[model samples]
Each structure stands twice: as C-alpha cells, then as structure tokens.
Target: MEMKERQQLQYEHDLRNHFDILSLSRLDRLKHYGLHFAKYAGRLARGDAEAKSRNETLVDAFLVALSAANALNQKLQNAEVDTEDAPSDLAFTDHAGRFADACEKIDHLEEFRSIALDANAAITDWIVRNATVRGVDLDALVDERRKQLAQRAVYAPGS
Candidate 1:
C-alpha cells in the first residue's frame, strides 16, 4: 500500500509513542532524541563525504532531523509531500563538513539551541532533495522503516 505524506511532527510523535519515549522523563526523552540525531548525523556526514546517497541513510537522517526538532520542542513540518524526481541541483557541493559541524554543535546543544534546530531542519531538506535527485522513493522507504521500527525486538510489541 502507498503511504501518504505526513508532517515531520507526526513522525516524531509516531517514534515517541512507538518507542515508549512518553514514559521517560523530559531529560531522558531529550537524550533519546539527541542520541538518534547524533548517530544519523555522523553517518550522514560520512556518506556525504563519499558523495553517496544511500536511501536508507537518507531516511535515517530525516528521522534524526525530526528527533532534533522534538528535542527542542519545535514544530518541524518541512517534509516535501508528493515530491517528484528531478535533476540534481548543479549547485550541489560537499556539505559534509557543515553537517558534521552541525552534529558537533548539537551534541553540546544547550549553548546553540536555535542553530541546532536550523541545522537539523536543513539536514532534513538535504536528505529529501538528495533522495529525489537519486530517483528514490523516500515516502515508501520511510514507511517501510516505520514498520520495521515498530516490530524491532528492542521495543515491546504493540506499544
């Protein structure tokens, strides 16, 4: 079945509820969001360095971006619904360093709250655009990922 486009906040809520993040304290929940963001941000930096647009990594980065928004209690609704494939932007250049730098600042996020949110949102856009450029189905991929996440052994079933 085809999945419809959803807001970034919907993704965040799905993740939180699916993973029982709602049960944790505010600080721990922030940590949870931050950890996922950091993990994918690092991976994205590496992938960008090689100029490889791995579909899975792109989705992961998108999810991480959502998590970053969640950590800051910000409404992130920048998902590009029904995006169509097009040529890669000619202006595309190495953004690995900037992404890595964003990850670093977000790691110590309290001091750079606003920018961290912006960086994460930017990461989300980059991932979507890159995936589209590579002729990938990001919505389908993310829907599959959401299913996998829901069934993962780590989380109790049927949360």
Candidate 2:
C-alpha cells in the first residue's frame, strides 16, 4: 500500500482533538515538529536513541512532518504533484535542516504562508523519497502508528 499524504493528514486531523496537537499555539506546534524532527534525525544520523532502529527514526520524522504540514494548513491536495522524485543527494540532516528552516521562516515573509506550505510539502516529499529508497513500508508503519494513537485517545485524560 502506498503512503498517501492526504490520508495521513486526515488521520492526524482526526487525532488532533484527542491530543490537542493542532490546537497548540503556532510556536508550540512548530516546536513540536522541530523537536521531534531533530531528535529523530539525530538518531538516524548517529545510530543512537533508545532501542529504535534508523528506519523507526525516519518514520517518526515523516509523521511529524506530515502533522506539522497539516497544522500549517497545508491542504495536501498537491500530494500527487509533489510525489515527483526529490533529489536523492541530500542527507537526512540536510532534510531536517531544510524542514526546520522552512518552519522557522514562516514568520519572516509577507507571503510566508504559501511559501511555508510549499516547504512543508517539499520536506514531506524528501522523507517519502528516502523511505522508498530504503524499502521502508511507510503505509504499514503509518497504519500501526495511527492505531496506537487511536488507542491512546481512548484513555486520554480529557478524551
């Protein structure tokens, strides 16, 4: 099964109310994505972070990017268009840096919204590209993660 960005966004949105993720202040949401992205990228780059494998870090980064994109109001309607091959030369750190720069610049431009959303899609594309190259079953991973999120929601303090 292919990893569909729109579907992933929908799943994140569905879990938003339960986790109060999307409702977070813009800076907080950006921090959420940034921190997770940095942590996972560190693990993937250094081969250290808990007992998780590199691919697991990749999945974490990918999911956070998708959720961050959605929080930034990226409609993800351009997923098909953005699915075109991203440059394979960039390292995971480069990918993480680009995403952080993108998110950070959202407040710096007069037309930053569109530009940031484009960056959001671009960042997601790079991860998807890496996943494909590494033969990671993103669909399966996402499915498992979403299920876990749903189950957690059941016992959420306010849910």
Candidate 3:
C-alpha cells in the first residue's frame, strides 16, 4: 500500500485502540498541540520555562504516536512528509498530526523518549550486525555520503 494509505489505516487503528485512553474529541487538537509545541520550543532556549514544559508535552504526544505506529508495524520514513508540501490546513488528517495529538495527551514524555531512543539503538545494533557479517561498515558508508555532500557544497555556485 502507498504511504498515505498506510497512514490512514494506521490512524484508524490508533483511533480504535487509544481514543478511549486519550478522551480527545478531535484529531485537530493533537495538531494544535504539535504546532504550538514546535513554535514554542524554538523560544525554549531563550529561557522560557513554560515553553519548555509545552515542548515536552508536545514531544510526549509525538512519542505516543510513534509507539502506536511501531506497534502497528509502520515505517516512520514512509509516514513523514516534505515540510514544504505538508498541508497546513489539513494537519489533523495525517500520521504526523496523529502523533502530535498523542504527544499532547502523554504526561510523561521521558518514558516515550527513552523508548524511541532504545528502538533506534536496537536498529543500529541490527544494522551493525548485518554489516559486520557482510564485511561492510554502515557508518563508513554514511560518512562517505556526507563527504560527497560536502564536496558538492564546496563546488556549488556562490560557495
């Protein structure tokens, strides 16, 4: 199935499973939480305690969505969209939007964060295992890609 179709199905599943737990009325509320959290987090480094709190709250919601997606065997890269092409008005209609709501409803963002971190670490470990078996270093391949990007930047116009 296409990414959007998968997201739609996933959202439907999340709604069926967690809607009772969240007590949320609409998906848009989650979108609002995410949007406000991001906008606020940008100012968090400026010493705004409230913004920091809000930032964590929003992140918590995102983590909940991530957890749900993982449970449903969904791919994050497939669910994520290009920022420029993302719909501002229909924010509540996508996987990202559902994540925003989940984060907002989750009071303990730290647990969610740790879970995400662990998941990433596990993936890295698996990749390393497979690469070692094949006599390849994934990190070196990534570094080579980065070097190529840097070289391109150096030769680019007005650089």
**Per-prediction backbone clash count:** 0, 0, 6
Best lDDT goes to which candidate? 2
lDDT by residue (47-158, candidate 1, tens digit) is: 5574545577667656655554555676655556365563233212223334345445645654545555565555566766677667788778877877677666455476
87-155: candidate 2 lDDT, tens digit per residue: 443465665676677667656743445545665666677667767766677767866765666656666
Cα lDDT of model 1 overall? 0.56
| Weakest 10 consecutive residues of candidate 3 by summed lDDT | 84-93
Candidate 1 similarity to native, TM-score: 0.59
Please, what is the whole-model Cα lDDT of each candidate in the order they appear? 0.56, 0.62, 0.39
- TM-score per prediction, in order, is 0.59, 0.68, 0.28
Candidate with more favorable, higher lDDT: 1 or 3: 1
Which candidate model has the greater lDDT, 1 or 2? 2
Per-residue CA lDDT of candidate 3, range 5-105, in tens? 53454455445444443465334433343564345334333445454443242333333434343443445443222233322212222333334435554
